[model samples]
Target: MDIRRWALDSDFKVTLTRPRFTDGLLLVLLIAITILSPRLLPVRSEGDTVLVRAGESVFRIPLEENGPHRVTGPLGEAVIMVRDGEAWLENTPCPLKICEAMGPVRRAGDVILCLPNRIYIRVEGREQTDAVSR
Candidate 1:
């Protein structure tokens, strides 16, 4: 029989062992899980739907008439409008008004985020082809 002995000082010591192939495989698996996790995870999405997030509140607005509407928030306000086959954030009280800068979202996958007011507006349901066309 053989034995190995190690001496320790007053300071705390940690012993680390090198990872083997199986450990590498496990790491790869974990990486894959992290990479593809969002797809596997549950998300709320429907055909041509709108998502509105304001402060601690979140809601969904369904597109119907394609017209103008106001979305109020804690920090400020925003105006959402649809015209001539395009949807857009027309006005915002935030200083930068970056949301308004993201103009004319006519298809799905478009987003208008107002950082100051903590508001997020997204357009959903247009086809991939249509998105590319614009």
Candidate 2:
């Protein structure tokens, strides 16, 4: 019988498929995983290496050391300061001080980037990981 004919039939029988137990279980499992992933999954920690990027050049420095490193890019000079296992963008020629305002980042993937200057500071190879928030 054609579906169109069945639709027009006065005594046409129609039924809806009911969800199985496995389907409900799978849905609950997916929701649990999503809720717990953040607390269970690990985040990268602060590293001993600080990478200063200037245009096509990349300079790697030890984050454990205390000092200011200078990098030059399109906008001019920018400084990265490292003190007591923390690093931040000290100064940049960019009109917006957004990069400098990021303050000290001690986590592995944390970055201080100067868009106008094309400079970036990043950390790598640390023993401890970042907190759960990130």
Candidate 3:
């Protein structure tokens, strides 16, 4: 007979909960990954490693070495030199020697590519980034 009054008279206490890890196993995994992130990250180069990719193959050389290095690609050989603080493509056997014309690249991310030779060259450590976003 007094249904509305009965329902409205009831007092309730509401409680809040602190955020917690829903999955213990996942929480442990996340902790482990965070702890290992430093070692697992790609080694940051200081423009010290010169990388060359020729078709299916990749090669690396130290920029600190003051001398010329040669990498043979599909077309022929590309010669690169490293000096006091820079590295450059000396020559490439491709038709235009286009790779050689790229000039010296001292900064990281700088690249020289020869399409005919399937050769790609880049300096590592030119710039250090925590992560790349696309």
Candidate 4:
């Protein structure tokens, strides 16, 4: 009856396992996403189209055409500027002028709103690549 010696001399052993095929596949996917992230993901200033809505009118403007544009709304007139591939709310009749301070927008789905004036400036177009990307 040598129970203490039998317990201390047990033959059980633990071994480490090698990585499985799924683990390798997951690692490859992660690396691919990391490398292609800049191109695949949407950016804030990657579009070249602009849309301005004032009252019942919708005006479509191209970002490449640099100039100041105007729109009329309930409160009066609003000015939008397009320059260097970007568009911004330059002036508005609303009391606070919040829309004018909203700064430039150059990406699809970007919008500047002047609730008091009943006007909005939006960017609506496909994502455009820069000259370098071409």
Candidate 5:
């Protein structure tokens, strides 16, 4: 019943707080969500011919064989050549040659992005025949 006695009790000590188990569980759940969200979401495939946009610049690359080609704009223009079942950047106006470093990409999920020129080359999968298309 005495306020002073209650305040001085060992149970009322401020520094004696124990870590709650729920806090650890919540932290683990947050990490799991972060790791799984991207994998769970549907991603656009590169098999279908699509325009890849990096910033304002857009490049249209085909998904078929000899389909993927590089495009150059007014500042500098170059086209990628695909021959003998290989792809390579034939030319570029940029001085750093960073796009050339990307080399050849054959897979359906590859991308070549030039940040300076705002150009993106994406390899997408071909669309399958479905009732909607028909």
Candidate 6:
């Protein structure tokens, strides 16, 4: 039997095998893990703090403190201001300065990143169901 003749034969048929019981069980296990992973992980306690990172330095500032806190990065100074339970980037030495336009962050997990200056700012608190609702 020549390989080409067999491949081109008129009686040739191609079919997909049905999934076995073990395969179905594996799929169900995967779905369960995906649904439960987030709940299984420990949730951090809610806090009124903001975590700021610039280059090698890190600062934890309370959201209740209303002031412009400055941190230096590779480029220059980056000012993060906290007022009325919200934190935002007031100024950045980065070229684009897009981080400043991100608006205020009051809810937990909100982040303002300035990649050009290597700055990262995050608001810390209890996890919210979603960003839009929070």
Global lDDT of each candidate: 0.68, 0.80, 0.75, 0.79, 0.60, 0.83
Q: For residues 8-95, what per-residue lDDT tens digits would candidate 1 score against the true structure? A: 5425454657878999999999999999987775443333666767777777666654778777777766777866546667667888
Q: Give the C-alpha miss distance for residue 46 in model 3, angstroms.
A: 5.9
Q: Tell me the tens digit of each residue's lDDT in model 6 across 47-105.
A: 58999889998879998999999899899987888888888887677887789898888
Q: Model 6: runs farther than 4 Å from truth?
A: 1-47, 129-134
lDDT of 2 by residue, 7-98 (tens): 66858676547989998999999999999987775656557888888898988888788998888899888888889999888668899898
Instruction: Quote each prediction's TM-score.
Output: 0.51, 0.60, 0.57, 0.61, 0.44, 0.60
- Residues 1-134 of candidate 5: C-alpha lDDT, one tens digit per residue: 86557768857744446778998899999999999987666543335454566456665645444644656554566666564444556567767878779887554556565666556665555422221321
Of 5 and 6, the candidate ahead on TM-score is 6
Overall local distance difference test of candidate 6: 0.83
Which residue pairs collide in model 2, if any?
45-129, 47-126
Query: In model 1, what is the error at residue 67, expressed in angstroms?
Result: 2.3
Q: Please report the TM-score between candidate 5 and the true structure.
A: 0.44
RMSD of each: 13.3, 12.0, 13.8, 14.0, 15.2, 13.7
Predicted model with the maximum lDDT: 6
Best TM-score among the predictions, by candidate number: 4
Please give, for residues 2-61, the per-residue lDDT of candidate 4 as tens digits.
655665677744344798999999999999999999878655556677877888898788
User: By lDDT, is 1 or 4 better?
Assistant: 4
Give the local distance difference test score of model 5: 0.60
Per-residue lDDT of candidate 3, residues 1-134 (tens digit): 66556556767433445656776678899999999987787654447777888778887878888898887788777777889857777677778876677788766776777789887778888365554562
**Model 4, runs deviating above 4 Å:** 1-45, 126-134
Could you tell me how far off, in angstroms, the CA of residue 45 lies in candidate 5 after the best superposition? 9.3
